[model samples]
Target chain A: MAELIFTEDPEDPRLDDFRDLSTADRRPDRPGGRGLVIAEGTVVVERMLASRYPVRALLGVERRVRDLDLSGVDAPAYVTSAETMASVVGFHLNRGVLAVADRPAPPVVSEIIAGAQVLAVLEGVGDHENLGSIFRNASALGVDGVLLGPGCSDPLYRRSVRVSMGHVLRVPFAPLDGWPEGLNLLRESGFTVAALTPRPGSVPLRGLREKVGERVALMLGAEGPGLTAEAITAADLAVRIEMVAGVDSLNVATAAAVAFHEVAATR
Target chain B: MAELIFTEDPEDPRLDDFRDLSTADRRPDRPGGRGLVIAEGTVVVERMLASRYPVRALLGVERRVRDLDLSGVDAPAYVTSAETMASVVGFHLNRGVLAVADRPAPPVVSEIIAGAQVLAVLEGVGDHENLGSIFRNASALGVDGVLLGPGCSDPLYRRSVRVSMGHVLRVPFAPLDGWPEGLNLLRESGFTVAALTPRPGSVPLRGLREKVGERVALMLGAEGPGLTAEAITAADLAVRIEMVAGVDSLNVATAAAVAFHEVAATR
Candidate 1:
């Protein structure tokens, strides 16, 4: 069971990890940045406990702390009054519970490509919410893993974790070392890397499964100004979600979900 | 041409529709509700100008006002400095432009159903962003119209309009009356009312296109606690997006996009 430590002091040093969360948990790679993975609310907290990330600590109200099934949770869980907790954290958090975990080593890119039947390759997906939604979609739709290309935000950022419903922790993701050339790794591994672009000469999203085999590394870019020209050229082929004339392109995350469904669905 | 009357004062009664927009555009039916349809940013403003809603006035910086193709716009375009715009809006309106339009009489639900080939019937999807995203997806994926069932937020809400990239202005939506009984109107209109749920015995969404004909009314509920049991029971058949075990359900908007694409795809 996780150790339950009750604290009333707002200035307690032990509660430092949960402090000033709004901006503090933003850039995990920056200086003075505590690179801890933070999970908020009970649903996400439970998912954190179940993830591969090592649990560091937990802070929550008495009821919330007690409500969690903390069996084998080695870390300390601090139970505090909401007011004291708010004073420590710099703002009121209505989620009632929070958990912080140390990020595990990133999975190897080659390994993700090796084991994946269907993979989502993302480039320029810097928006935390969009990145998180992609992870959630990847998880639910049976995408084996995600390969993070350049300009992708850190998936372990607190907001991304929350927005992903903690699926960011569950989905295996690794940064692809090279740029457009890095896409060759999937091709070499018997994966058909198809870039999702709206450019002319690209194939429509439908009937893509008929063209490609079982292994697919589906590449997606940010919402506006989709995949760079070089990235599109590097992929095996370009695919697009056909839409009506004059409508704005789908949001990147929603587009990812639609494409992921098409890739995962049994036709 | 839109009359670009420059204003220095923030207290101009002409800007009332644009004031305190964070709360003003909410609950258009409530007491003290101005009930004006508001669109933020230049893209949505242009969409509003081309929509059925009557453009009442515009509040924007000079560059943004000049950038719009305002030919034939009968409404007054109030040009103002950023400082004055911020003061009048009760916040820093970063989008550089804002347009408010008087909502025309809502299209009849039967009329939307009659003209529709594919429609989305939303129940308990009260989140403004999600509702807007659904509209955007519906427009792009060729879902002809939207039927707002119980617990749905107003698609004309300012946040929905902005999130929808002004597509809400383009796609027709109408309120579905009489709860579950209202669903019969769709069935009578030759729309196969398919309730999207995760319940057992539900047909998977993968091959849904093979079964359903041209017209489909895809019903979706909010994120958690999906469609009410009564709503599911009332539909012609239940459909589910198959997922990996133990994963959370897809976001309401994301799921709608997946389903819409399936319905719209040329197989």
Candidate 2:
């Protein structure tokens, strides 16, 4: 079990990781501008504790702190009043409990590909909420891993962590060094790289199962601009979710869920 | 052409319809706690103009107001500086424009069902953003209309109108009276009512086309506690999106999209 510490001081030095959290993740000197993983609320905090990321410490009100199963946890659990907790965190967090963790080494790209049956290759998914939602969807739909191409935001960002419901910690992801050219690594690994787009030449997402290999990579881009020409050309084929006339496409994360379900489920 | 009225005063009575917008949609005596339809930004404003709602007026910055095609609009478009727009609307609207319309009479449920092949029936979807997103997805995926069961919020709420990218104005919806009992209306009309759930007994959403009728009415509950037992029992059949073990179910709106694709797409 973890040691419990009681503190009422908002300025306590031990609570530095929990301070002024609104902008704490953007410290320029920190690696990735986000050295610590923050899990808010009980459900997410539990996920962070169970992840490969090393738990640093926890800060929460007494009632919430006492409920956590901190057995085998080496970190201190600090119990503070809600008022003092708010003062340190720079805002009132309705979730009541928060846990912080140190970033673990990301999984190797080749290793993730070798063990995965389905993967999502994302480019330019810069929105934090969308990125998190994609991870949440990926986890629920059984996507094996995610590959981040250029222009994607960090999945470990605080906003992404919270929005993904801590699934960002569970799903393995790594930044692919080269842009569209790097896709060759997957093709060589026996993965069919299929770009998701709405071009007329593309086939509908339905019946995609019959057209792909054992391992599939669904490539997606940001909502408005969609996948670039080079990315789409690198893939084996382009697929689209059939949409009605004059309507904008689904949000990137929502579209990813539909595609993930298609590729994961057996008809 | 619509009249353009320029004003520098934030207290101008002509902008009354757009004042204190954060709480403007919650008039107690108003039907459904929403009396006016508010469209924010150029895209949503354009949709509202083209919708069945009767335009009352428009408030926008000079650049955004002048750019609109107001040739046949019967209402006044109030032009103001950005600062004045913010002061009047109680917040900074990056969208730079706003339009208000009187609530139009909702379409009759029977009429909507008569012309629809695919429909969404929602229950306990009180969150404005989720309600808005569901409408947006329904519009994009060719779901003809939405039927609101109990516990659902008004889709025309300002936030819903904005989050939906104005699709809420275009997709017709009407309250479904008599709770689950009212579901008989769709069944009587030759529609298969499928409740979306993650229950063990539910059939997989994939290949659902083989089990349902020509017209499909999908019944969805809110995120956490899905359809109530009563609602599920009322449906002709219950269906589930196949999910990986231990992960939470998909968001109510995302789940709706995947199911919509299955019913609307040609595999």
Candidate 3:
């Protein structure tokens, strides 16, 4: 069982990881200058406890701490007054509980792709909310993993984690360094890379299942600026969600969800 | 051609329709105390210009005003610096433009459902973002119309207009007054009302396509407290989007998008 510790001091040095969370995503002093993996709210804290990332500590109000199941956890859990907790975290957290964990080494792109039947590859999804929503969709649709190409945001960012409903911690994703050239790696691994775009000539999304049945990689880009010319050209085929005339393209995350369901079910 | 007036003062009386917008949604002195319909950004403002709502005026940066094709619009257009516009709107206007219009009379529920092949009926979807997302999904997937049940947020709220990418103006929606009892009205109109839930006995979403070939009304509820028991009981069938084990349900709007594609596909 995890050990429970009581702390009252807002300036306690032991609570350094829980400080000024509004700007916590950038930590110059930490390795790689990235913030620790933080999970807020009981549901997300429970997800962190189940994930592979090693939890370092927890800070929460007494009621929240009492609500958690700590049977197998070995980390220290700190219980404090909401006021002191708010002071320590630099803002009032409505979720009432937080868990901090170190970043685990990311899986290799090949390793994630190798065991997956369905995969989502994202490029230029710089917005954190879109990245998080994609993860949430990927998890729901049973996509095996995600590959992040250039211009993608950090999935471990606090906003991304929260928006993903903590699925970012559970879903395995690795950055693909090379641009459209690296897409060849997925093709070599027996995955058919289908670039999702709204271009005029692309086939509708429903036909993709008939085109690629086994290992499938659905490549998507940001909303307004869809897949780049090079990215679309490199894919085995281009697919699109047929939309109403004169309507703007669907939001990137919502579009991914639709495509994820379409391809994942076929496999 | 529409008249364009340049203004420097942030507190001009002509711009009153766009002032302190963060709290402008509530207007007891207005026609129905339901506030003016507000559209933000160039895309939504353009939609409002074409919608039935009477355009009161427009406040925007000079660049955004020039981008709009307002040949037929007669409302006064105020061109100002971003700073001045931000002060008038109560926050920084990232979209650079905003249009306020008097709310048009809502269509009757029967009028919206007349001759519809597929429909989305929402209950307790009071969050502006979720409501907007639902509208966007409804438009993209070709749902014929939306029926707002009790506790639904106003679809014409400014945030909904922007987040929906201006689709709210194009999609028709009206209130369903009789609650769960009123759902029978849809059945009377040759519709199969399927309640979307994750319950054990619910039919898979894909199966819904085979069961109902005629007019279908897909019923959805808020995220946490899914369709109320009364609502579910009123539904002709209970449907579910099959999700991964141990994962929470998809976001209400995302789920609706997936289900809409499944139920509305004619081919």
Candidate 4:
């Protein structure tokens, strides 16, 4: 069972993992970055506890800690006053509870691809919120896995985790090592690599389900600057959502959902 | 042509519509509310200019104003320094331009229904960003109009306008007056009134396109408390996006896109 330790001091050294969280939990390669996987609120904390990531500790008000089913949790949970919790975290988190976990090594890219019927391949989706939303959409739509290409942000980023409603913790993701050339690997594995773009000559997403064979990979890019030319060329075919002329393309995550519904939902 | 007038003072009475914007332009029914339509940044401001709403004035840096093709604009465009604009708006204006328009009387709900092949009917979707995203998706996926039901926030609120990328100015929407009973009006007008919910006995969205006949109205509610029992019962049929079991439902906007792409994209 998880250990419940009551503490009143805000500056305790044992609580360092929970201090100044806005900066402390940034990408580990950056300065002052511990790279801890931080989960906020009851739902996300529960998700972190269930994920493969190792739990380091938890910080929350007494009531919040008590509400959680900590019988299976092995880490120490520090219960403190809300005011002290806010002071230590450098922000007033109304969610009232937080969990920090150590990120395990990411799964091999090929392994994620091997087990998937449908995959969402992302390029240049650097916005944290968009990255998170993609995961949430991927999970709901039955996309088996996500493959992050170059320029994609970390799905485990705090903002991404919050925006994804903690689905980022649930979905399996791995970084594809090669760039546009890596797309060839999908074709060799009997997957149809379909790049999503608005450029002329792209097939309308309608009826696309019938055209692609069994396995499908929906490749998408950032919103404004869509999939690069080389990426499109590497794909077996290009697909696009029919839209009103002169209107901007749909947000990448929204576009992914539409594509997922069309090609991946049934599989 | 828009008259470009230079202004140096931050407290000019002419700028009152843009003052303390975070609170000033709330729904007119609220206390201290003027309920003016506000558009931020060059793109949204340009959309406001082309919209039916009467443009009151514009406050922007000189360079941004110069970049706009203001050949037919009738309003006076006020050119101001960023510092003065910040003081007037109560925050930094990073988008570099702003436009305020008077809210014209909304179109009758019947007119929007009469014209649209596909319509999105919303209930209790009060979050501005989600509301804005729904509009953006509706426009891109060929949803003809939107019918607002009870508990919905004003889509013309500043944040919704910004997040919609000004698509809110283009898409026609009107309030549905008679609650669940008002849904009967849609059935009379040839809309299927398919309520989107995950409850048991709901049809899978996968082939819903074939079952709904010609016109379709996708009724959606807020993210957490989805369509009410009364609302779902009023619909001709309950439909749901096929989702992975044990996963949370898709965000209302994302779900709307999936439905729109299925039923409306072709039409």
Off by over 4 Å in 4: A27-34, B27-33
> Which residue pairs show backbone clashes in model 4?
none
Q: Once superposed on the true structure, which residue ranges of model 3 sit more than 4 Å away at CA?
A: A265-267, B265-267
lDDT per model vs. reference: 0.89, 0.92, 0.89, 0.89
Q: What are the TM values for chain B, all candidates?
A: 0.96, 0.97, 0.96, 0.96
Query: What order do you get sorting by DockQ, best first?
Result: 4, 2, 1, 3
Query: Could you give the DockQ of candidate 2?
Result: 0.76
**Among all candidates shown, the one with the greatest lDDT:** 2
Query: What is the alpha-carbon lDDT of model 2 when measured against the actual structure?
Result: 0.92
Model 2 bad stretches (over 4 Å): B28-33
In angstroms, the error of model 2 at A247 is 0.3
Q: Per-residue lDDT of B185-266 in model 1, one digit per residue for the tens?
A: 8888787999999999999987888898878899999999899999999999999999988998999999999999998644
Tens digits of per-residue lDDT, candidate 4, A31-104, equal: 44537888999988988888888999999999999999999899999999999999999999999999998878
> Mind sharing the TM-score for model 1?
0.96
Most DockQ-accurate candidate: 4
Judged by DockQ cut-offs, the docking class of candidate 2 is medium
| Structure candidate 1, residue pairs in collision | none
Please give me the total number of clashing residue pairs in predicted model 2: 0
User: Tens digits of per-residue lDDT for model 1 on A87-156?
Assistant: 8878899999999887677988888888889999999999999999999999999999999989999999
The share of true interface contacts that also appear in candidate 4 amounts to: 0.92
